[model samples]
Target: ESPNDHINSHSINNSINVISDDDVAMEDVIDADDSAAKHEQIIVKWICQRCTLVNSEHSDRCDVCSSPR
Candidate 1:
């Protein structure tokens, strides 16, 4: 009859320990892809042939994916 009698922390610890290096690598790749996908405003207009993503024509890089022109 104690206040702490009904706590289930065993499963939580097991789950935390189950994460593998592959999971971490996949997460990093996803994060990198996401970051590379963020748009940066460009003053000039440009076109992306691969993705159809547009940017400033005078811009050296694509705003949507950072692809070099």
Candidate 2:
């Protein structure tokens, strides 16, 4: 190949590598966000005053005693 063609191909390869690296980084960020979301969900439980049972945020009443949250 000509020198100019070799140089152009090298630069194209470098660009492709940069793009792939960016995609991987973006996926890492997305995975981190999902993990944070799952942690938040896990931490969103409320303690039942009547029964002292740990209930999820989606529950309006105590799971064990039916006490209002």
Q: Which ten residues in a row have the lowest lDDT in candidate 2?
A: 14-23
Instruction: Put down candidate 1 lDDT per residue, 1-69, tens digits, no spaces.
Output: 886787555423222111123112111221232334433222334466556565544567677777777
Query: How high is the CA lDDT of each candidate model?
Result: 0.44, 0.48
Every candidate's CA RMSD: 16.3, 17.2
Where is model 2 more than 4 Å wrong at Cα?
Answer: 1-42
Colliding pairs, model 2: none
Tell me the TM-score of each prediction against the true structure.
Answer: 0.30, 0.39
For residue 46, give model 2's deviation from the true position in Å: 0.1
lDDT, model 2: 0.48
Clashes of each: 7, 0
Clashing pairs in 1: 44-56, 44-57, 45-56, 45-57, 46-55, 46-56, 46-57
